[model samples]
Target: MPPFSLMRCGAYLIPLVNSPLAVAQTTHLPEIEVRGPRDSSIGSADSASEGAAERESFQSRPKLRPGDIVEAVPGVVATQHSGDGKANQYFLRGFNLDHGTDFAVTVDGMPVNMPTHGHGQGFADLNFLTPELVSGVRYRKGPYFADSGDFSLAGSASLDYLSALPAPIVDVSFGSHNFRRLLAAGSRTVADQTWLGAIELEGNDGPWQVPEQLRKANAVLRYSQGSSARGLSLTGMAYQSRWNSTDQVPQRLIDSGEISRFGSMNPTDGGRTRRLSLSGKWFDKGRDGETQISAYAMDYRFDLFSDFTYFLRNPVDGDQFEQTDRRRAFGAQGSRSMPNRIGGLDGLLSVGAQWRGDRIGEVGLYDTVARERLSTLRNDKVSQDLVSIYAQQFVNFSDHWRGYVGWRSDALRYDVQGRALAYGSLNSGKGHDAITSPKLGLAFTVTPQHELYLNAGGGFHSNDVRGATITIDPQSGLPAERVPALVKGRGAELGWRFQPNDDLTATVALWELGLDSELVYVGDAGSTEPGRASRRRGLEATLRWKVVSHWRLEADAALSRGRFRGEAPEGEGDHVDNAVERVFAAGVTYIGGPWTASLRLRYMGPRALDTLNTVRSRATALLNFGARYAVNEHLTLGLDVFNLAGRKGNDIEYFYASCTAGEVASGACGGGIDDRHVHPMEPRSARVSARWTF
Candidate 1:
């Protein structure tokens, strides 16, 4: 039997099990251990937009929230609109991926994106993640990989956790705004098996007229044995959180001094959530092939109170609402890969299958007043099932040319049971949908230091089940048109990578993506909002240079244009709403002896708030600084400053109709007022931490 081998295939690790005699005929082999950070993906990546970041890279940056770790990916940004407990608003390329609509995230082989969620279609909350336990993050952009399926039209990310830590660690942190955190982690070996355990506790009172009293707790445990060639691991995780939310406020009110920038019209808006999961993975290497399998089960609960439009509907009761979701999910995935000859050329063939099912006990929306339910607008139970199969062929066509050709197919089923409503018997139905996607990638190695890549693929994102089978609108008993269960998309990219030496590397890419329809199912309203077909084209570039032995510089930038495909609607234009136009980020780090210091800056360009492009958001820039010093072999001190310049900006903005109490009392709220709703960015803050190792 040959030693186990693994290779990267998109966001997945393809197991290259067996080796030919020509390469494994050695009679004696010496044990080798590799260490140090992987600063570049010169020879391991197939496309310019695909890369992996080690724990050392992101752990050194200043993060305001746990989700900020994702920002380490070039051309990506993560911001918040509500409380810290909620999912972070993500933007990539030119799309505003609200709560991860077109992005897929996974941790330890367990999917994080919840389909048919209560708050959004694909809600992905990362508050449960503990950054210190992360081993690495692998990310890929575009739909040119068969290993990724739904919610991957824009990109996908997978975070891996360490099986064992070098030593026990305890950390304590304190910051402004009443922020505090404590974390502890350790690992022990017994009976040839390793046991790892970690726990975290955090709390914060955000800067708002109505403080966001956020409290959160998280824990993880794992047992593992064997090496990379053959291994088995079982992990369990638990998390719980609660907080008060200060959603976006009207800009007009702030400008008129009727309300402060951090003031909330509804102080009773907040949410509570909890999750428990058990997951296991196993892999084996054999003479003929290799096999990998993983399975997971999860229990989840959520309750949220929100008021996006304060008093727009009911003047006396206010426009507050509550959304609830309780569910259980189970999933399994497996893959097999083997070395095979294709047309007399060396090649590897891989096949994989995935299955997931979600049993939702109750997912509902209700009218509320001051955190109390006034009436049930919609209540239902749902069951969703997904099955996917994919195959890929990787071949070394020649000494300098290689590529992969792959295909994937997915099938979904939805079953909903609804309670009778005041208007009629609506929101109950069964539907099924299936789609097939093809992927192609070609790469040419011009020299040891340069490469060119071309890729194209087909992909799709599933819509909410409620929208697919809706017959009558719950709010107005009027007939409604059913939307497709799944929307299709296509993308292509041309990329180049240059790495003249070990100290410097650069990559550039031109990409385009198109969607059949931009329709979105609004979970808050329990209705589907219609939209026209759309297209996005963009250019992205990234560079990483080790200026000297102790200094490193990194930078990335993107420019994108998005528009509707055809003629505009009566009031809409060609411009895509909330489509980010430009993004630039740069960072420098110095690591020498016992001191490590870093400085980073990020710039986000203005975006259109509406289709007409008359309403736009202001561009903003933010800077952060961090430094750490090793006081001794057993202790370390660190400091981080966020919003170092104290610059004022908006984290998010939307143009919509909302009413105020004064306007309603004066009979001026005929149909509410159309204005810009903005969520201001957090003010300057600092945190200091001390860590002890044993």
Candidate 2:
């Protein structure tokens, strides 16, 4: 039978394959056929912190931006300080992963995090994501898996896109602040092959005093043949966006009535970016073994204008600067798995290898005013390459006991060519590094519905190539010490999973992670910053309960503490700046006939703003609401309300020194003024959308 569309029944959505309203009519519903993600059952999962979210979960949540889709992972929060066209800020565990550093993300077999980027190391931009095409998200915490390599120190998430859709769809939306969007998607089968395509267009003028004026376009085309057991696919994607941004501001400025909370110090602070990619994959599965391989190539460009200090660095130029990056990247990965018998026990062995290279034509930083460059600070052409190999063996010692051990090794090489005359020649160099990590996991099933797990692993994040080879500081033109090419980390987790019944599932985990060094390249400052060793320990809990036939509830909470490992310099303590200490989220959903509604609440606890632990930031909380109604078989409508309570809070905050024009003219800019800089969260707004299916 052809797949039928989803139907709302009470507080949940279920697919209707045979009959409409079949769930309401029967006490024992048909077996659910969720196909994309693997089940994280007692015997199948290695840790309690690992889980998967399917398309249904995505459909039920109310998201404010494309990157919000990753929030499906418990204890992860996605927020933004820049305009809609930029990557969302991600916070997970106890770490504020600025632009996805230490946390890896992927779609299909293509990596999303850009290493050694102009803005920051491991810069991940998901603005091109098309939510409707995502089939599932598989997330793992603590870097315990052998298949994951760079930027997996904190965690990793892999997203899978669907090869076909049940029906063609067209969607349109409009919202407060002149937000508008349109999407069209479809799939067709011919000659035993399926072809899928989608296009999206969006624009928004935010509530900021200076309009965001965001414009974005995205497209995807894919072709696939056969099933998961044996498949071949090719895909192409394109994305482009431009927008003006309201960066963080000093709270004192707002308190003194100098500017509104949602105002920008420099209206020209914004960015434009574009990406084009082509990828292909082939896989085969059989009783003897399984084999999979994939390859991808991309052309990317980025241009950004930002002013963080007003007039601190260059009082005459207003401290505004422009960053430009253009690169061509290519990568390929292949893996094979084989069934085995070890000591008369069932077992499996898997091995994989991956290779990636980036040819950066030019990555530069310059002094600028009103978005026009005045003088170059630094510019370089870079070539970086990486190769990784890993192997894992999984064995079932008994019906209740299972374990796995793995090992991985990675090698990296970098070459830099100077383009600018003043600071480029002295900083350009060549470097190479290598590292190996070991991983192990054990799981014990105490009962049919309960499981205990222990996991420990070593992981690492590569330092920016420029930082690893730097001989001079671009800003000050002084001799600089080069950092190690790779920084190592280790983590351990003890977890429990309890699933008493079909309607209830709960998980709790106690985890700790430590890094050998936190040294990294500071993109904003055009230099490298030294760091100390640090450690973080945390407890996380998640709960999901189906209260009744019409109502469902879910909640997640995390508490963590992070500190430097040893003594600190005078006037500074052990606190890790911007390390989040607490997080909580809860939601309720209601489904009745063709109607569905949901309400969600999120909280972020206060954090230290400086290493001294003297300055701290305030906690923040917000609420959101969403509802959908099926007008007919062909049309459906949706409503989403963000910041439902119109809360006045900040999306992000920092303690820093900056100087305004007035301060500079008055000679008060001496060393700048220390203050709290913040980016206010958006106020209450609503969006209405319509989707048509045929």
Candidate 3:
């Protein structure tokens, strides 16, 4: 997505949203005056969804994964996934920053929220996302109002699309993982109206192919009108994806002197996702101001993975456990605007309403030595509904100061009718619940070039923790546990943001966070009560600068400490999941018209793998380099050389071998033992690519 697409699309949407929302001639940044998606764009393509708010994000090539983009903001850190080839995760301010918190991620407004129990080591399909369809991307740090839900602990990333352009574009690239991709987009003007379309396909024969191969495609279609003085516009789209299931690795192979062996030796994905959306907006800016309404729907599924566990950790005998998931959802949101003043400066008021509904089902089955189906987990049903109302104000005090604040509340209700998980004495359980949530936020600039902010927020999660998945809880009577209720966290940040000019942007922040009701699985033995309290505090900082357009420099670093506030006799919060001591990122880029080059170095400090903290892990750093060059007006080329330093493992890596412990590693037997000290990771590799755009 280009930042300019929104400005272009907004050239027409502004009237429908309200003409008062449009940029006046007086605003200093003329290049981003168009109020579409982003508020600014630098060396990036003219089109970007950068927004008109104080937010944070990692930066990366559009063709790359979200993990590749974490360099955008300060304090955020991500590690490569080799042991668990799942979603890329970032440690937000020394705490666990998974799909649940730290930040919410979305593509073209589609939220990606999927998490498993116990460890934060799972991955989803966002890796398949391609940047070709993105027009703009918005990021927000801290609490956001009803518009974004209460899911963000560190922040949120919002992406926008621009389907309209004077010309058509197509991009194609190939590299490692048997990696290959094709992305194409185009726009057409008709009867004074414009329509846009995009299609993207990515496939890889991933290096760790213990039968692991991935292929995916995403398509989009949208339409808009010319400059709409009447303040009215409309857009719609559909998207779909299909891929192989996540492969778990076999522990024995590593102990047998094979650290980089594929476990299953034959893995496959049996899942797919499909979605569609349509929205309408009416901004009678021709009248008092602007009013807008938009809505969308999604349909998706996760096919059964028949005993892929043998791929991660082997049992004497191969067993297969697979399940299928079917899901559908729909929602809409509308906002109205009015003029105002803040600190005797220009300001705007916005009021909005939002609603959505969801339905899901899961089916399970067993696989035999001959790959025959056995039985299935009983069927299940779930329905959820959400409605919210919110208002916000954006104020520009002067060329040197700006302020923003907002409030929102929600009425939520949901129910589940299925064979709930069995926790020893607890069974035959089905449940229903409802909640009302409120959120608030504020940001102020101490100077035009620096800023400070504080926010308070609330939200809930209907974690679809299937009953069959068991994590032994710390209790005497209960053999297992069931997942229920939403997790909540609140925190504050004192930070400074400085943009000396378009050439550079930097930030530093110190923060403390509290998760009031989040769940954690811990204890020496299965016990009765829930987990104890937990706390996280940390410091984060980053700096980015464009040097003479021909050279760019960037660096980000984070330091933190976290732990269980109190020792629990039995229950969750026994230990921290994503606690880290330090993280750093440094990069440089050079642009020479048709050719652009970039190099990045990443580092992580040593960390503890267990709560005992008796043993610790090592630290590591790697260098990455890449380049993009134009072949012609419609063609371009790109390549990346990662882990150029060829480090064996990262900070989170830990492994045990025959030379170590006795019974514990032997798991009740006297056999030679190998304890997993830390998660395993992949080493240095290289990738290359090419593309064409019109």
lDDT tens digits, residues 502-541, model 3?
7777667676666654433221110012334566777777
Residue-level lDDT tens digits of model 2 in 512-548: 9999886433323633354889999999999877789
lDDT of 3: 0.51
Better of 1 and 2 by TM-score: 2
Best by TM-score: 2
Q: What is the C-alpha RMSD of each candidate to the true structure, in Å?
A: 8.3, 6.4, 8.8
lDDT (C-alpha) at residue 288 in model 3: 62
Q: List where candidate 2 sits over 4 angstroms from the true fold.
A: 1-35, 519-530
What local lDDT does model 2 show for residue 418? 79
- Give the per-residue lDDT digits (tens) of candidate 1, residues 275-306: 99999999999877899999999999999998
Please identify which of the two predictions, 2 or 3, would achieve the higher TM-score against the true structure: 2
TM-score of each: 0.93, 0.94, 0.76
lDDT of each: 0.84, 0.84, 0.51
Error of 3 at 155 (Å): 1.5
lDDT ranking, high to low: 2, 1, 3
